[model samples]
Target chain A: MLLALLRRFGQMIFVMFGISVLVFLIFFVTPGADPAARIAGRNASPETLEAVRKSFGFDQPVWVQYLTMMKKLFVTQDLTSFVNRGWKVVPAVLDTIPVTLSLVIGAAILWVVFGMLVGLIAAATRGSWIDKLLMALGLVGCAMPVYWLGEMMNLVSQSRYHDTWLFSWVPPLGYKNLSDDPRGWFLTLVIPWFTLAILYIGLYGRVLRANLIEAMQEDYIRTARAKGLSETRILLRHALRTSLISFVTLFGLDFGALVGGAALLTEVVFGLQGVGKLTYDALQNLDLPVIMTTVIYASFFVVLANALVDVVYILIDPRVRSA
Target chain B: MLEVRDLRISFRTEHGRVQAIDGVSFDVGESEILGVVGESGSGKTISLLAVMGLINDPNARIEGSIKLRGRELVGLEPREMRKLRGREIAMIFQDPMTAMTPVYTIGWQIAEQIMAHEKIGKAAALARAVDLLAEVNIPNPREAIHRFPHQLSGGMRQRAVIAMALSCNPALLIADEPTTALDVTVQAQILDLIRKLRRDHKSAVVFITHDMGVIAEMADRVMVMYSGRIVERGTKAEILLEPRHPYTRALLDSIPPLEGEKPKRLRSIPGSPPSLFDLPKGCSFAPRCPSRFERCAERPALEGGKHAAACFLKVAS
Candidate 1:
């Protein structure tokens, strides 16, 4: 067990390192992605571009330049944005880390809870009208894009229904720190959280319901019935418990990408300065340092989520341990 | 200890209503082993499922009387059925590899069974589970309980299933094709264990299988089912020695000849069993029977006392 965990940790580090290097190589080696050329004015003289390159150490050998960038990113943490003058890339990304985390974590919790609820209800009432209705709703939720849903939500809650009792409690669109204003943080993010979770709730519900309904027909379920367990006990203890193995895996996979800036559209729709938004801004300006850091950070989250999924799988399924 | 009469289970599918079980009836006394033998789709397992209150298909319509210890089982509320299950009647399903919840350790599964019917503490129930495992001849019972079902061999998992079934010392123990999925050697070991369990617990057993040879060794009375009806039933001696039904004869003839005799081409009954949706009005086996007669157009009811066969030739004779 210890060895497996250690191996997983090593794999995470390897992945992050590979991603960092790949992004670095792409930025420096790609034609016209040169850092100094990107920072210099577009119509600058060749001498002016050469001067910029020398000042930024881009004239050094590629490996030396890569080391310098890594040191600036990790050790001194003073890497500046190329397009946005005087903007320190690392601190800006770091400052927005909690915002992304707050958004993704809240949405994840909502999705998982409501997703399982939808799945359980659908499975229990399978083949009935209620089941069909939930399934159709889930499909609709899945098909609706986050940006579109977010805009629809904001339109109804912030403008059309602002004075109505239903959405009157809606807070202004923006980000709030949980430590500074717990209630405001919750109020501000609730709509965005729902908007972000809608897709997953639908997807996860359909997936989990399918798994749980199939699990009901398993021989173990028959054994459970013969053993005289209550329907609730059988569903919760045997069916749901086993079904969650796959559900947990799916959640882990989605959670990683969401935290890794898959929530960019949701962040943008709500005007939250999250990693996704930061990455989007960096991409617009071709900010090499911010792009590199965000790439490493996103890969780290994805790999970390995968590792956590493996751990959860081990806990949920004894059979997985030996494998 | 158990009585079932005119039990019928039909399902309303999109195609038509399929009568899976038609007027099946049987009884099991204390310390008795009633072997129910039939091939796949014979309704033997379906009948047992109905009796166990495990039939959950919403399209199914069940009708008949099933009394256990004189308590009416038909129409018993699910809650009441839940209470009676595992305590009064426990079942050992076919395919032990799939019969157990794969994620849990064998110990927790067994303990869950015991704890379900009683208010005992978990530790106490788990301890009893280990003892039950030992009783079923599982090696290293203590450690075996901690292992997942997949960690154990097929035979060992079946043994664990049997151990779970016997956890409550149920009055009626139903083993449904429990040995069909095991190796020949493992089959014999499971049979021996089931026999020992019956003697030790004095529980009435309903052993369901398609293998007549297994029926010979495990049953006191044998019931032969074909297409949702009992084609023949009698004492083990009567069914094996003086089998009356042509289907039963065909089944017996199909068993491979014993050693020391010259090897010969094996005989098997031709034509698969009919579908539940489109069963003929005549005897289900009439079309396939060698001695089918003109009167076979009309279905023949099972006739005789102590020994019975649903065939005109046998009744006329």
Candidate 2:
């Protein structure tokens, strides 16, 4: 097991390295793009353009440039955003981590608990009115786009009924640091978490329900029944336990992506300055340093998530242990 | 003792109601082995599964009474049925490879059955699990208990399943073709283990199988089923040596002879059993019975003494 983990860790490092190189190459390969021109700002003096080029190493080999950028970003810790003169790229990215982490973690818990409950209820009461009702709700949740849902939520809570008792308790938009005031932090992030979680809850619930129904039909379930286990026990222990294998795999990928700035729609609508918002702004302004940092940061989470999934997979499934 | 009377099971489908088990009736006494032999779809497994209250299809309709130790089992709530299962009556199946939850250790699975009905602690239940393994003749029982189902061989897994069924010392043990998936040598060993377990536990055994050899080796009483109904039933010697129904005779004849002159070819019943959806109006076996006559126009009900045959010919003579 330790060896498997070590192997996965090794693979994660290589994957992150490959992603960084790929992102770097793609940034420079775009047609007629000039990092030096962009960094120097509009109508700059010729000498300023030369200085920017030399400072950013646009004149050096791509590998040497990559290495220098890595050194400035990690070793020297002084990499700054080219577009925003005094803004440090790493600190700005690091600052957004807490907000993004708070959003992703809260939404992940909400979706996992909500989705698994919906799936289990649907599977257990299959062919009943409750099953139909839950599945219909899940379908509606899935059909609505996250951005549209977020805006509609904002419209209702922030404007249309801002003074209503239901909406009064909802705090103003934007994130509050947890260490500053935990209650405010929770209240501030609650709506965004649900808005982000709705789509995944629908998707995951439907998938989990289908897998669980299939697992319930397995011969082992029959054996469980013969063992005189209660319906709840049989469903929880024998069926859902097996069904969660695929569910966990899906969760790992979704959680990783969300933490890596895929919650841009929710973050934007809620006015929370998360990594997703930072990435969005960097892309619009063509801030190469900030963009590179964000890309590498996102890839790191994704690789780590995959490694965590592999480890959890072995723990749950005995068949994988010997392999 | 267990008694099933007028037990009927049907499934509702788009095509119509399919009668899976039609008016089946039988009884088993304590410490006795009743062998039920039939081909696929004969409702052998279905009947036993129904008795265990394990068949939970929404479209299924089960009628009549199943009495264990004179307590009515039909119409019992799921909660009540669950209490009876694994405690009063336990089951083992044909494919041991898939019979157990793959994620659990064999000891944990065995202890689960014991812990389900008994008020035993985890440690005592686990220790008993090891003992059950040893009782089933699994080598290194202590070590084997910690292993998963897939880690064991086919024979070993079946033994583990048997040990689980015997964990609670159920009053009745239902073996649903338990040896069918095993090798011939392994099959004999499993049969021996069951016979020994039955003797030691003093539990009634309902052993379902398709092999007549298995029935002859393990059964005290035998029942021959065809198309969801018992065509013939009697003591093992009476059924094997003097089968009364044409279907029973045909089944016995199909077995290759072991002595004298070898036949040029083995005898096989000419026609296959009818589909449950569109069974013949009369005797279900009439289509395939060589001795079928005009009198077979009406369905024959099982009748007569302890040794009985559902036939117009009265082959009992």
Candidate 3:
């Protein structure tokens, strides 16, 4: 186990290095790209541009510039954003990490719980009307776009029926710090959570339902039933146990992507200043330092998520250990 | 003891209704082994699945009587049937490699069965599981209990499955091709284990397989099934030594003798069994029977006797 963890850690470092090189080349080494001029801002004096270029080492060789940028980002930790003068890229990302983690983690929990519940119910009642109805509802949720869904949710709770009893307790757009006020944080993020989770709940529910149905047909499931275990016991303890492997794999990818700024649409619609929103603003302003850091940060989550998934995969399936 | 009378099973598919098992009846006496021999598609596995109340297909229809100790089990609800499973009746399946859940330890699975009906403490159940492993002659029972299904060899897995089936001392044990997937040597060993388990537990056993050699070696009585119907049944010696029904004779002829003049070619019954769908109007085996005559065009009744054969020729005599 320790060896596997160490190997995964090495892989994570390699992947981060590769992504950083790619981002650096695109911003600094690409033809016609001028970080010096961009940092100096539009219609700057030649003296100001030269000063910025020299100070930031943009006038140095490509490798030297890359090394200097790495030192600023990692060692000195003062890689300021070109668009926002006072904003340090690393600290900017760190500050928004909690907001993104809250949104993604809450939505992940909601989706997993509801998805498994819906999937289990659908599988149990497979050919009945209950199965059909649940699956159809899941399909509808999966088909709806995240941005559209978030807007619709806001329209209903924040404007259309803000004074009504149904949405009276709804909070305005924006995120709250959980450490400052736990209840307020929860209430504030609840709608965004549902909006973000709705699509996944459907997609995961359908996938889980299919997986469970297939697992139920396995020879071991018949053995479970022959053992006199109740259908519930057989379904949960035997069928679902094996079925969760695929679910976990899918979750790792989805969770990592969301934390890496795939939740930008939801954050923009809900007015939450998450890493996704931060990345969106950086992209709009062509902020190279901020974009480079966010890209590397996102790759870290993706790589880490995959490593965690592998560990979980071995935990649930013994056959993999021997293999 | 177990008694099945006029038991029929039909399945509805997109094409039409298929009569999978047609009016089959048999009894398993206490401490006796009844070997059910049949070729594939003869409902060998389906019949036992029905008996175990494990057939949950929505399109399947089951009728007639299944009585365990004179209590009707044919119409029993799934909830009530669950109470009898593992304790009153236990089943071992065909593929030992896939028989047990792969995630759990073999010992945990056995303990699950023991606790399913016994209300025993976890420690006692686990101790009993270890004892069962030892009873099945597994080496290092203590270590084997913690191993997963894939870690064990094929023969060991079969033994573990058998150990689990006998954990609760069930009165009726149904083994469906329990050794079919094993090597010839492993097959012999599994058959011997079943025989020993029968003697030890005093449980009536229904051994289902297509290997006639296994039937002869393991069964006290044998029943031959063709196209989901019983074609012949008698004492093992009576059937093996002097078979009556042409199908049974054909089945016996197909067995290559260990010591004898080697035939130019091994005997095999010509043609496959009739499909459950689009079955012939008369005898289902008439198309494939070498001795088929004019009377064979009509259905033959399964007559009652110490040795019964479902053939018009036998009835005429």
Candidate 4:
């Protein structure tokens, strides 16, 4: 088991290295992406430009620059954004991590709970009107983009229905730190969480439904039935247990990607200053250091998520342990 | 211990209602082993599934009566059936590899079945599960209890399945092709284990298989199903030695001989069972029977002969 874990750790390192190198290559490949002039300000003297270039190591060879950038971004942790002018990109990215984590984690909990319920209900009531309705709702949820949903929610709560009973509790759109005000943070994130979760709820529901239905046909289920298990017991303990394998895999990837700034659309629409939003603003200004920091952070999360999925697989399925 | 009368199970498919089991009936006495033999789609497995009340397909339509210890079972509410299941009636299935939940250890699966029917703590249930595993001849019951289904070999898993079926000491144990997925040597060992279990526990067993040899070895009584109906049934000795129905005779002839000089090529029955979707208007076996005659155009009732055989020739003789 320890050897397997060590192998997984080694694989993660290899993947992170590959992704980091690719991110660096992609950044340099773009024409006119150099940051020296941008760092020195709008119209800078040659001496100042050269000085800024030396400090940032823009004049160094590509490998040396890459190593120096990695050292600043990770080891020393003082990488600065050219667009923000002296703002430490690492700290800024780190600060937004909690906001994204708050939004994604809350949304994950909601989606997982509701999604399993929807899938379980649909599978149990299969071929009935209720099943059809749930499936249709799930499809609609998947089809409706998160940005549109977030904006629509914002319009209803903030402008159109703020005076109504339902919307009266709606706070102004923006994130609050939990440390600053726990209740305010909860209130600020409630809508964004739902908006972000809606798409995945539909997605996980459909996937889980299909998996549950397939699992219901397995020979073990027949044994379960013949063993005289109650319908609920059979569904929950036997069928649903096996069906969760695929659900966990899907959740791991989606959860990781969302926390890694893939929630940019929802973040932008809801006015949350998350890592996604940070990456989005940095992109428009072509902030090199911030992009680099966010890219590596995002890759770290994705690789880490896949590793976590393996661990979850070992828990939910014994067959994976030997492999 | 068990009686099934006029059992008919059909399914509503896109084409039409397919008669998967058509008017099959049989009885099993306490501690008796009744072997059901047939080709694939012969309704052997379906009849047993119906007996266990495990046929949950929405498209299925089941009719007739199943009586366990003189109590009506057909149409019993699922909740009531659950109480009877595992406790009064348990089932072992083909392909033990797939019959046990993959995620759980063999001991856990066995203990879960025990707990499902009895009011026992987890530790007691687990202890009983270990004893059950040891009874089935699984080596190192202490350590083996922690092994998952996939970790065990085919024979070991099948033994574990049998242990689970026996956990509640059910009055009736239904085994559907339990040895079909096993190799020849393991098949013999499992057969021996099952025989020992019935002898020791005195639980009536309905063992379903397509192998004549397995029936010869394990059955006191043998029932041969063709298509969706039983064509022949008698003492194991009677059916194997003097099969009267043409279908039964063909099945017997198809078996590779052990004593006589080997044939240049092994004999095989021609054609397959008729589809339930569009059955011929006569004996289901007639289309495949080499001795099919005029009387076979209409279904012959199971009658005449020392035992029962559903063939016009047997009736006339």
Candidate 5:
């Protein structure tokens, strides 16, 4: 077990390194907008541009700049944003991290539990009216875009019924720090959480329902039932564990992708300043340093999520460990 | 000991109600190996499943009495039936590859059965699992316990399944073509294992297969089924040497000789078993039975001493 963990840790480091390099090359080496111009803004004079270029080491060789950036981001931890005019990006990221984390984490919990419940019910009653209805709901959830759904929700709750009991308690159009006011934080994110969760709940519940139904047909499940296991035990203990293999695979990749700023649409529509929003703004302003940092940050989550999935795979499946 | 009498099962399909098992009856005596030989869709597997109360199709209607040690099994609640399955009766399926859950280790899978029926802790159950694996002659039981079903070879997997079925020392073991998926050598090994298990545990076994050689090798008595009904049933010697039913004779004659001068023309059953939906009005197998008579338009009843056959010829004799 110790050896396996150590091996996984080593793989994680290698993946992180690869991702960091890719992010650096894509943002820095790729021919596109000038980092100097982006940092200096449109109105900077020649002297200011030269000063800004030299100060951030843009005048240095590409390899040297890459190494310097890596050192500042990892070794020294003194990275600052050229686009933000010398402001430290880490503290800014730290400020928004908790809110995004809360949103994703809460949505994930709701999606998994409620999705599985719906899926189990649908599968158990396979050909019944309830199954058909749940499946129809799943299709709607999968077909509707998250951004569109968020917009629709905002219009209905914020615009159409702002004075009504249903819409009166919606967040006041901004994120609140949990430390400053936990209630405000919850109220602010609750709508966004539900909005984000809607699409996933549908997709995941259908996938889970199909997988569980398939698992129930497996000979092992029949054996389990034959062994006198109750329907509940057979469903949860025997069938669910096996079906979760695919679910976990999808979850791992998705969690990483979401953390990597794939949730930008939802963040933008809801006015949440998540890493996704930060990355989008950085890209728009051609801010290389901020963009690179966000890329690295998102890459870290992706790589870390994959590593966690590997560990989870070994735990859930003995075949993997044995091999 | 288990007794099945006049068991009939039908399924509601798009065409109409298809009779899958028609008036099938057989008794598995204590410590006797009863071989059920038939091709696919012969209702052999479905018969055992009905006995276990695992049939879940909403359209399926089952009528019969399955008595195990005097208790009627047909009308019992699912919960009660479940309790009876692994405790008093157990089953090992045909495809060993899919017979056990893929995610859990063989030890965990076996231990699950033990824990389900008995109030045993993990440690004790695991220890018992290793012991059972060793009894089944798996090499390095300790190491093999942690390995998943996929890691094992076909033969090893079948052994693991058998070990699991025998975990609770069930009175009856229903092996639904257990060795069908295995190669010849593995098939022989598995058959040997089942024979040894029967002797060691003194458990009655209902071994389902299409191989006459397998039936000759393991069965004390044999039942030959075609189109969801028993065509012939007798002692292994009687069925192999003197098959009363033409379908049984055709099946025995169809086996290719392993080492001898080959026949110029291997005998083959003339036609396929009739589709369950459009079954012949009278005899189900009349189309395939070479000795079918004019009176075969009426269904024949099972007759003849302890060894019975559902045939007009046998009934007339």
Candidate 6:
């Protein structure tokens, strides 16, 4: 197990390196955005541009710049943003990461627990009116875009009736650090978390319901029932564990994608300054350092999420251990 | 001892109500092996399932009294029935490969059964599991316990399943074609293991199989089922040698002896068993019975002594 983890860690480093190089090439080597011109603004003279280029080491070989960037990012840990006038980028990332992390983590907990309960209820009452109603609600949740939903929620709770009983005490729509005030942080992000979780709650509930129904049909489940295990035990212990395998895999992939700026719509609608919003802003400003930093950050999360999923596979399924 | 009396099971299919098992009755005496012989869809599995009160499909309905040591099992609540299933009466399935959960190790799976009914610690359960594995003749039980179901061979998996069925020392063990998916040699070993375990545990067994050779070898009593009902039943020798019902006779003749030179044309039962949905009005086997007559328009009830057959022609003969 230790050897496998070490191998995976080594693979993670190589992947992160490849991702960093890709980000560098896309930002620097690409034709559309000129880092030299952007850093020296339109008012600067040709002499100032030459000096800026030389100081930033843009005059060096491309390979040398790449090596220097890697050394600064990994070894020296002094990654200065050219667009931000040589201000360090890592601190800015650290400031925003907790907000995003809390949002994702809270939303994950909400969706998983709520989805499982809804799924179990739906499956238990399959073909009943309750099952149909829950499934229809799930369909609506799946179809509605998160941004539209978030905006609608804000319009009602924040804009339309802030003092009304229904809207009273609603979160003010900004993220606060959990370390600063846990209660304030939770209250502030609660709506965003729910809004972000709605779609996944529906998707995961449906996936879980379908998988649970299928898992119950397995011969082993029948054997469990035959063994005189209580209905609750049979469903929870045998059926639920098998169904969770697919759910876990989906969660891993979806979490990684979300961390990679897929939740940009939610972040934008909620006015939260997460990686998604940061990446969007960097894209708009053509900020290479910020964009590259976000890319590397998101790639690390995606790869790390995949590694976590691989570890979970061993716990969820014995067959996967040898594989 | 277990007794299934006047058991009836039906399913509402698209076509109509399909009577899966119609008025089937049998008994498993103490330490006796009652072999239920039937082709697929002949209600052999359903009969045992009905007795266990495991039929939960909405379309299916069951009626009858399944008395285990004089306790009625049919109308008991699921919780009460479940308490009896693995503890008092255990069942092994046909496909050993799929019978065990894939996510857990063999030891954990068996230990789960032990812990389900007994108040035992994990360490003690593990020890009991290893002992059960060794009892089932799995080589290197200590090493094998840590291995998952897929790691074991087909025969080994079946042994593991048998070990689990016997873990609680159930009074009745229902093995539904336990060796159907195994090779001939492996099949023999499993049969031997089951017989040995039955002797060791002193538990009555209900063995379901279509193989006459297996039934002949392992069964003390035989119940020959056709068209969702027992056509003939008797001691193993009576059913094999003097099969009163034509269906039973046909089944016995169908088995080709291993020592003899192969017959150019082996005996095959004429016509298929009637579909449950479109069963004929009187005797279900009349269409396929060579000696069928007008009197067969009335269904024959089980008759004779300990060895009985539901046949109008046999009764007259």
Give the Å error, residue B205, model 2: 0.5
TM-scores of chain B alone in all candidate structures, in the order given: 0.98, 0.98, 0.98, 0.97, 0.97, 0.97
After TM-score superposition, what is the CA distance of residue A179 in candidate 6 from its true location, in Å? 3.2
**Candidate 6 local lDDT, B119-197, one digit each (tens):** 9999899999899999999999998888889898999999999888888999999999999899999999998998898
Writing each residue's lDDT as its tens digit, candidate 5 over A1-323 gives 78877887787778767877777777666788477777777899999999988987889988899888888877887788765666877777766677678778878888878788888888877899999999999889889999999899899888999889988998666788888999998898888888888888888889999899989988888878777788888888888888887788888888888877888888999999998898899788666667777777777788788878888888887677767
Q: Model-by-model lDDT, in order?
A: 0.92, 0.91, 0.91, 0.89, 0.86, 0.88
Q: Score the docking of each candidate (DockQ).
A: 0.84, 0.79, 0.81, 0.84, 0.69, 0.72
Q: Tell how far residue B112 is off in model 4, in angstroms.
A: 1.4
C-alpha TM-score for every candidate: 0.95, 0.96, 0.97, 0.95, 0.87, 0.90
User: Candidate 3 on A1-323: residue-level lDDT in tens?
Assistant: 78888898899999989999998888877898898888788999999999998877778899987887788888999998877777788988998999999999999999999999999999999989999999999999999999999999999999999999999999888888998989889999999999999999999999999999999999999888888999899889999989999999999999999999999999999999989999888988788788888888999999988888888889999988888
Q: Considering the two chains of model 1, state its CAPRI-style docking category.
A: high
Error of 1 at A202 (Å): 1.6
Distance (Å) between predicted and true CA of A242, model 4? 1.8
Off by over 4 Å in 4: A1-8, A29-57
Which portions of model 6 miss their true places by more than 4 Å?
A17-72, A75-84, A164-171, B118-131, B139-147, B289-301, B315-317
Itemize residue pairs with steric clashes in candidate 4: none
The TM-score measured for candidate 5 stands at 0.87
Query: TM-score of chain A for each candidate?
Result: 0.96, 0.96, 0.95, 0.93, 0.91, 0.93
The candidate, 3 or 4, that scores higher on lDDT is 3
- Could you tell me the lDDT of residue A119 within candidate 1? 97
Q: Least accurate stretch of 10 residues (summed lDDT) in model 5 chain A?
A: A82-91
Write candidate 6's Cα lDDT for A1-323 as tens digits.
89988988888788888988888887788887567888788888999989988999999988899888777776787888776776787778777788788888889999989899889999888899999999999889889999999999899889899789887878787887888888889877888899999999999999999999999899999898877777777788888887898898899888987877788898899888998998888788777767778888888888889889888888988788778
Worst 10 residues of 2 chain B by lDDT: B308-317
